[model samples]
Target: MDNIDKMVGIRIKTRRKELNLTQKDVYAATGISNGNLSEIERGNVLPSSKALVSLSKLLQTSIDWILTGEASIIDNNSPEISNIEYGLKLNESEELIIFMLRSLPLEEQLDVKNYLRAKVAKYEKSELSSTSNHGKNVMDGNSEIA
Candidate 1:
């Protein structure tokens, strides 16, 4: 494989692993077979335009990034976290939250941040409580699966 192909394959592989998705998961989502995906990741064969598009959407990146490793900038302050490329990786709800946050005044941003922190704390507490109860239930022979 040539240098560009290898680089593209490496990017694909890296993004896939970052998302904690397997080749089989990608295949199921993109309709690209596992063997073909493996070959693409290995840079043994060039992906077709259709495959590239599908992979880009499934992997939440752009074709340009996949091909040339150049991601379009949306925010200059934080290239990795606040760029259009990073936004593309977020779901619709997350993107909307980011957009709304960006629209708010500087002082309001802190309020929103605090609110989000509180929500996160509440969610973590609930999760911990549920987990502890589940463990107790399992130990007490009251778990459904047991």
Candidate 2:
């Protein structure tokens, strides 16, 4: 197997161990079949991008995190998590979330929680500042999406 395949296998095995889940559970969640998932996790075969996305979701991590161990996709200052891309294609939200987690160190889950809380506070402060500047009338009849 190539590097990518090996990485996939390693990530699958790690997640399975962490979650106390079996290959069967992954198969059921990803609809990949036990034998296939096993082979993929063993680095006996390469998985398609679609299958990788499914596994990422079941594992609750991002494809980028799984494949490259990089959680922040675009690496901007905002905590607005970006989408996870598989090569040129992109994974959905669940897959992206999983991929992001996969990139995180085992000890950093708490860090992520703290980071999210701080970002939420920053957003709330910004909202309050905007509202106060506009006064009561500006917000009274307007129903604008933030």
Candidate 3:
């Protein structure tokens, strides 16, 4: 692959990680295949302009940043260009978690996965209970819809 292609791939991979997204997530949102996304991220294939546009929107960055690693001169003073730097940075906690997970043994990884799934289920159940109570309250005129 060309050097420019590698740079673009790095940008894509970096933004995807910063957003805590998997290739599957990016594929689902952008209609890019997971295999293609992997290839693009590895710099084994150059991304199409359309793929770059979709990725730019979904990853909340600019095509300019993805390709050239800078805001175009014309957009330097724009408020909208200010957040692009953040897109290249993964959260420290997220980076730690990924590092830890990768270091775990396979069985321990499965244990961690199970623990996270249970926690997520608990959170979802609580959210559903709260939503149901809120709906009931509104229907009974005991609470105003806000």
Best by lDDT: 1
Q: Candidate 2's C-alpha lDDT?
A: 0.68
Q: By TM-score, who's the top model here?
A: 1
Candidate 1 lDDT at 117 equals 95
Instruction: Write model 2 residue lDDT over 100-121, tens digit each, in one string.
Output: 7656653454467678899999
Model 3: lDDT to the true structure: 0.76
Q: Which stretches of candidate 1 lie over 4 Å from their true place?
A: 72-146
Q: Which lDDT values do the candidates have, in the order given?
A: 0.77, 0.68, 0.76
**Tens digit of lDDT per residue, candidate 3, span 12-123?**
8987887677887787667899999988998889889899878886676678888888953223223333345455555666666756765664346567978999999999
- What does candidate 1's lDDT look like per residue over 1-146, in tens digits? 79888888899999889767788778766779989988889988878999998887666677888999897512422334544545546666766787787566434656787889999999999999999999999999898764
